[model samples]
Target: MQLSFETDVEAFRAEFAAFLDEHLPRGAESLERPRSTAHIPEWARRWQRLLFDEGWLLPGNPPEFGGRDASLLQQYVHLEELARRRIYHSFNPQGLGIIAASLLSFGTEEQKHRWAVPVLRAEKTAALGMSEPGAGSDLASLRTRAVLEGDRFRVNGQKVWTSGAHDADFILTFVRTDPDAPKHKGISVLIIPTDTPGVTRRPFGSLIGPADLDFNEVFFENAEVPAENLVGELNQGWTVANGSLGHERTLLWLGFAERLEDLTQDFRPDGVLGRDRYATLVMDLQALRLMGSAALARAARGEQDVAALSVLKLFGSEAVQSATEAALETAGPDALAHPARTAPFNPMTLEDFYAGWFERYARSFSGTIAGGASEIQRTIIAERVLGLPRG
Candidate 1:
């Protein structure tokens, strides 16, 4: 697809560059990766608050919701600039991008005002409680139970891989509201305050040290949530959950793809791989970008091509992984001295950008795992896009 932008977008890009230059927080001079930013860095949080105040945070949103109502292409350019510069902008990905964006489409005015807007401005933070110990890829099988009593729902269950529950103001939890109904149909979503009486959190430990408890295990011991906290119709959380994941899968990788391309350009591969490996990496990166841009353009036009998105996710993620592997090969024995894992909440350092090679590589796994696992994405492409029958 031929992608073109108006002159105004150029103006917007210039403004964004100026603002980013002027507003970036201290200690933000390094080249950042997607995992380093899964949880927004401290300086980035400062930057986002500024963006929110200036009505540039969510570019496509309206003024009241802290957006510029910018076009998709404008937002695309905005994101591209961020990726190019390795700047992080979100406070929490689930709150600011996925849940709140989904709320714009599926929530009531009150819900939007109470939760979504604060989330946009970073005044309030939220986490998604979707995956359970036994329910990673099969999210609908979650066994968390919620029983309505009077005007509140008493929630009782555990959520694993629930990122940021330790610090999030609220958890957008999925619970079984009606056990007798079909597993998917009986499910419902609730915005439960993390400080609720019966709620508790345990941070997952890093095998090395200082893990991003951003990925957490939360327990609700009959925790109470107001009926008003329920988002969307009861027993219709599958739809709401899908809406959130749609935003995540579609937008989260834009920065990653852009960064991969950038890194490839800067990469000085030598030894066994050399230019042959570098050339192939560049070609793969460009192909991934083309598919991603086309899918994003279609999304901008209110179109959904499940297969196209699946292709973007699958190829984009693998391309990044491959690129990282190439970078690692170049790093050679130096990789042995580098950190093995990237913490979910900390910012990356550019001083020795390649010094922490494995972290970036290991971090790429989340991109494939979250929203939807790469395996599931391939299945979606096969069944929905290629017109294959379910096995």
Candidate 2:
């Protein structure tokens, strides 16, 4: 079957492909994924800067913001092509995808110039400050507080699971500014420079593998932040938080789809049972792609379907988990052997591919939790789409 679009959209896809051929690093598709989102090597930084300078960083935004005001369909095509090539536009996902997008949506001109521009240009990095120890999926239950003083706000609280915080220039933090108000209403967002006094960061490794220090716990003990750093109106942080999460969950399915596709080709399992499992996986992946396409079409038509996104998030993440597990089972003990750790990592080698199976399987678990856990997504789907009463 042939799927087609406007002449310009196809042209845009061709242009992006040619650009990748000319500028994308050779063997980038097989290069070992970075251990941490904040670990932007010199080459990766240069790549990000090149995308920004060439207006491919955020094609939906204006040119000054490293975009050309491309149409929704064009943006969709752009993302698809990038996903097909497994190319990353930036090392800091939250910084480029969530924080900067939020600032563009809600920040003042001065704030945009100060924070948003630097993040988009890859001149500075940012981390999202949400998901406290007590408030992972339930953001409204956060205990962090930021009180308004004469000219600055005194922030005294802690945020855990703050990705890339240790390397971030600033943190777009959510704090409770009005304790007397409702849980969601009392929240407010603050842009706190990581170097500010009383601010501390502690990096920690995750289950993905050793040397993967990707998440951090950030503390703000009487940290003084200027009042002007507020992104939107006071005590309106829930709105900003939702906006950030929306940006985050929007295109997450693309990566999962790409990974699952790669898995189907890389793992050749024997036996009828294993073959059947892989066949099921391939069908699931096709379904996910169709769902994503439908969601993109709805978005292009100016429709916002929150429930559809929740469905995609739920299905795509779990599908990846299953596919990775299948790949490990197919490779058996060979997949468990650790490949020799080497510099300038390339995964295309047979040894590297087998070694990565276990790590990929372990890392797939994070997808089920990040950007709202699978349980949270199921709740959203049941309550919103299925119209089922809360249990």
Candidate 3:
């Protein structure tokens, strides 16, 4: 768990810190507030470009792809700097961090130049199309179909809980390309243009903060994409998914752990966080950090433990939920009020990040739900990490 960066990383941090001071726009500091779904204000996109121009987007990619092909420590320092400044890592974090990572790992050379570069440049955004209305935890049951026809594939079905679908330029869609084969074997991933004909997205209603249009149910009615858009080998999507999933889970869990620590800082149990509970939550945050660091260390050595991600995912999410619960209990009567109003009344609140504490608290549950559910993660732990027999 030693995060001691190489000498080059130390220099990189000092340089990045200076850049943040000079380039960060006013009022944009510390936007990593919990349950805050606010994204892509024109200002943010402009800021994203500033980072892009400075070669700060992806340190692991080749220089041509807005990266420096930096060392492992340099990459770690890159993310740490962003978190320290509380800046959004990208205009499209999913695109830059998750989907782009996958494309870099599994995509053809042409795909990387065509898709990943635009994503890093912030000229386009991408959303992962994996979960379905009926096949969430049971992804093998997903029924979305994409039949190959000459140089194109005709896609049909629906994707639910699709984040940024309405705004993304395209989707890295997983569809059934061989129904006659086993469910898992039949699946394939495609890069489908969001604007393709017969593709439609409708926003879902929300009690959470920010725009409702960020999360949508996307329907593909015989949507079509060039056959060359296929990502990875056909029927090999399940393997392709692991590349992005592992990288994202590593970074995301670290973020959640860090945010939980930030939220509960200066926590007095006699106040919003009960004394014993606050102590325990703080310790849990520490444990989550160590786990995250361990995962990062492993990744630095080029060893990704699927089981470790499951453990981090489960624990990291549950830790947030616990912190949120403590915050709510600490707020007492004020917790029932709207987040905007509660901010003014709660003496414990110091930063604007707490303005929507309640909503953020409520939204904490999505951590366990999204990516993969707690139950599913536990199963991964049992079957893969621990070598336990399934029921």
Candidate 4:
């Protein structure tokens, strides 16, 4: 299949590049590595605001909801350009991208009008409340309970690995409404404002890099939200959650390709490695990119086999690990010893951030585990895509 963009997309790319050139933060190189989940720097916020104003931030949303009604391919181009510029929109990624999309798809019209605009405009950030201490990949087994009260649902549970919970205005959460129902059938999605009476957020330091990227654990005790906050049909949240995961996997795969390219270029022999090793790394990097692109194209075309995404996740995670390992080899003993240096078009302080990179390596292993483990992906491919019998 031809992966090349048509002329209109080429023009979109040019326009996006110009926007990045004009608005990328001045003196961003000298800025300290980001350290908190606070709003992005004013310069970066201005850029996001520009996109919001220009109706580009949520290009997939319809014009009535402040988007251009752009094609999925066009949306892909926008993301590629943004990632190429290494522009991290720290404001409300979860809100604008994942949660907003979920809400738009499954939320009531009132919920959509109430939540989507603020989310897309970065007026509010959102956290995902899915994983619990014991439940993650086996999401249907989650134990968070939302008991129905007269006019509200009283929620009580702890959600772990919730990114930006401490800073977010709300959480688009998954909770079990009927414990006796089959594993996947009793769950429900809810919108819980962070400032509710029984809600508490505690910050945790990063397992990966700076504290800014810290994921959190949130506790909700008798947190009462209006029954109207329920998203989609009650007792059917598993479907919505799965849909969100599918969207997330697609975005992650695309972002990973961009990051892999950035890392490969930064670690080139003249830049950071020896010639021979760099050549090998380049070839591996190209393969990873092609595999990811192919998977993304399939997804853009509306393929529902989660295994395709899982394959990209598995390959992308491994590719990142391999690239980092190669970089460590290229750095030799000095890898841990060199002062941290910031790369122009990558997450800041990547070189001397050995601790961070190592943390990422550990986390990449979890990428397969988090959304669905690699083994699970293989199972999905076997049963769903390949039509193999389940054991």
- Number of the predicted model whose lDDT against the real structure is largest: 2
What is the TM-score of candidate 1?
Answer: 0.89
Model 4, stretches more than 4 Å misplaced?
1-3, 28-43, 209-213, 269-277, 296-305, 329-333, 337-370, 385-388
* Candidate 2: clashing pairs of residues: none
Single out the weakest 10-residue window by summed lDDT for candidate 4. Answer: 345-354
The best candidate by TM-score is 2
Per-residue lDDT tens digits for candidate 3, residues 280-378, read: 887888898788778878888899577888898899898888787877877877776665553333211223434555766877888888777999999
* Ten-residue stretch with the least lDDT total in model 3: 342-351
Would you list the clashing residue pairs of candidate 1?
A: 163-214, 164-214
TM-score, cand. 4 vs. native: 0.87
Q: Write the per-residue lDDT of candidate 2 for residues 103-128, one digit (tens) a residue.
A: 99989999999999989988899999
- Of candidates 3 and 2, the better by TM-score: 2
Cand. 3 Cα-lDDT: 0.77
Judging by TM-score, tell me the better candidate of 1 and 2: 2
**Cα lDDT computed for each candidate against the true fold:** 0.76, 0.84, 0.77, 0.73
Error of 3 at 288 (Å): 1.7
Worst 10 residues of 2 by lDDT: 346-355
lDDT of 1 by residue, 50-69 (tens): 78889778788898887888
C-alpha displacement of 368 in model 2, angstroms? 0.7
Model 2 regions more than 4 Å off? 26-35, 269-273, 338-355
